[model samples]
Target: MTASPERQMELTLPMVPDIEIAAARAAGNLAREIGMASASIDEMAHAMIEACINAREHSGSQDRRIYVKITGTSLGEGNSRIDIWITDHGRGFNVTEARSRRQQLGAVHKRGWGLQIIEAHMDEVSITTSDDGTTIHMVKYGKNDD
Candidate 1:
């Protein structure tokens, strides 16, 4: 299949939760610009923020570094979709433990729901990591971007 036209934006953010709002705002604005509905934009923002928050909480480093990329295409006629990738350069995590924690969404914990929230809001979700770092990938499709 032929590839669709895509645009991408990248950001290198300090591994801090306070700065994630800008990422969400950027994602939301791009989603809207590409015809994503307001609701879908909100969902996209949520997913991006969740990923960033996860990086903030889990990534291990003296001066943590997070890399984020937002990519998407306008599918023509007011339809569009966007993919977001949040990457961190820190000590990786245990895939099994992380997966298990995500599964226990209602465990009465104050947090640990970021992964679940990301999965719920995005159309697709993928996670990959190694001793070097972790990357969380997610996508959202526009219903009526206008």
Candidate 2:
């Protein structure tokens, strides 16, 4: 089978209420075009929303903007995958330390579950953070992927 060219979309959003919905909608549309299952598309949208909200609230970026990139790559035989990267230029925090603190806080807490939600929804998740900023990378496989 021949490989198809990757499809990509990028969005920059000012840190504002209800803006995350636009990002989620764009992600859902791309996932659908890539032949991702409806359920997976919904999950991806949810993850996207959470990621954006997390960045907006916690990133502390002076620019007050969120950057999102979505890439869809064909895996041949009707299979495909979508990768999403969410970035914020702000003071960063240690992921490990944050996770530990969240664990201590427990599920009883109503907030700070964005990371957990994103991880639960996406097939693969990774994070990079430094004093400069934080970027979250997430991927979800298409319906036909084994």
Candidate 3:
């Protein structure tokens, strides 16, 4: 497989539990096609799943949509990076606030671990919230240095 000079794909679908699997598969396929390392792709796929699960479980039940945009770029010589944006159309919350609350709870709940897991795996994680909704931007490092 050859990596495209420009590697990118966009997927938009209903924010439902079942659809997350499709998204994960799509992401993994892209990673392999673009020559991303297996371990990096696996971590990225997991991050995407966690983000989508949050959207499906915590977001409103109806009329909710998730948009996924993935871009793979050659950073330098052989190094590459993958940027993934997962946006959900639902009532927005402050990511920082939610994280703080979860931490302060001092209890371990699987539900609140989604963001933490995503952050831990990805090279960079950013959360943007607005009246429209919330967007989670995650980036993973690829094997190639250029």
Candidate 4:
């Protein structure tokens, strides 16, 4: 079986209230087009929102902008997967330290759950950060192979 070419969509959003919704909607639409399961689509959308919000709130980007890219790749045999990347050009922080702080805060804090939420919803998640910027990469499979 031959795999189909990847389809990609990109969006650049300014740091603003309610702008994350647009990114989430775009992700959901792409997931749907790629035949991702309904539940997976919802999860992807939620993860997208959390990622976008984190970029906006934590990035401290001088440009005040976030770049999002969603790519759908066919795995052949009716299987597909969606990969998303969210990037911000700002002074990066230590993810490990942040996670440790969040764990320490636990239920007392009402915020700082974006990374956790994204991890819970996406099939796989990885983050790359440096003084230059941070980029979050998330992936979700279209079907439950198990």
Candidate 5:
């Protein structure tokens, strides 16, 4: 409902810890609305939690704000590609550096697994970051889309 659920959606959430729950809820609803399978919906929620957590901890947003946006082609029996954008206005880190750090982490590492979980779940993932903030763009296909 952010933008008619047709072309795109934009939502602003008060930058706060524990906001991931809200995100997961919204994602699950959208997935169901598009007739996505339960398994995929769960995966999307998992990724959303990781990303939202990262945004909360890393995105140095003094005002404490997080943004979620959804966009898709259509929802039905055919196929659809859903795109979600999670952004925060905090100090940004280099994508390459983050990946390298993740690669260097031990299997039992306690932290720094947000992006890793995200990349593992989503069909496509890309990140763009700068001093202004960080934005993670994640894509997933519907039940029959992939």
Candidate 6:
């Protein structure tokens, strides 16, 4: 069955590489506290870090501000899902084009692997872009109900 939406928590941080790790850790911890497995927490954290990095790095400036929002919900009877959204205010690029660029650049170096990694780990992933900014929505499933 399709997952359901629930409460949301939002965070805004300076678009700097140094802060991404911290943000990921905090998010992961929160996820775990809410019933996600350790591995799932790690995976979600990694995905969040990657998404934020892409927003800060390729989106625009090193000083740009990125907004992160997470929502958690109980699925079925014992399952839960968390949705994380990372947004950036910059000139957005096409997801398809971005993948092509990354493929040409290769994943060994600084290629566009964030989306792929996020997709690999998260239960759901969606991207919305406009002149104002771009937002990435990622969903992670947990082990139990609320």
Task: Please provide TM-scores, in order, for all candidate models, with all chains considered together.
Answer: 0.87, 0.88, 0.84, 0.88, 0.84, 0.82
Badly placed stretches (over 4 Å) of model 6 are 1-7, 61-63, 101-110, 144-146
- lDDT by residue (1-146, candidate 2, tens digit) is 65653789999999999899999999888877777778788888899999999899999999999999999877877777889999999998778765654544446656877888898899999999999999999998767423
Q: How accurate is candidate 2 locally (lDDT)?
A: 0.86
- Give model 2's TM-score versus the native structure: 0.88
Write one digit per residue (lDDT tens) for candidate 1, span 1-146: 54474677888888765778989988877776667789888888888887888888878855687788887788776778898899987787876676566434456765677877888888999888888888888888887733
lDDT of 5 by residue, 1-146 (tens): 33234556677888676789988888777766666777777888899899989988878887688899977655456565678999999989878766765545456666787888999899999998989998999988767424
lDDT of each: 0.80, 0.86, 0.79, 0.86, 0.79, 0.78
Q: Which stretches of candidate 4 lie over 4 Å from their true place?
A: 1-5, 101-108, 144-146
**Candidate 3 residue spans exceeding 4 A from truth:** 1-5, 101-109
Residue 15 C-alpha lDDT in model 5 = 61
Could you give candidate 3's per-residue lDDT for residues 38-111 as a string of tens digits? 88988998899998998887765346788889888765555677888988878777687666645545557535
Global Cα lDDT for candidate 5: 0.79
Candidate 4, TM-score vs. the true structure? 0.88
Runs of candidate 5 with Cα error greater than 4 angstroms are 1-7, 75-77, 102-109, 144-146
Higher-lDDT candidate among 2 and 5?
2
Misplaced by over 4 Å in model 1 are 1-3, 102-108
How many angstroms is residue 119 displaced in model 6 relative to the true structure, after the best TM-score fit?
Answer: 1.1
Better of 4 and 6 by lDDT: 4
Q: Write the per-residue lDDT of candidate 4 for residues 16-64, one digit (tens) a residue.
A: 9989999999988887776777888888889889888888988899999
User: Residue-wise lDDT of candidate 6 within 1-146, one digit each (tens)?
Assistant: 76555555778898765778977877776676567667778888888888888888888744489888877776756667788888888888788976554454445567677788888888888999876789998888877523
- State the displacement of the C-alpha of residue 97, model 5, in Å, after optimal TM-score superposition: 1.9
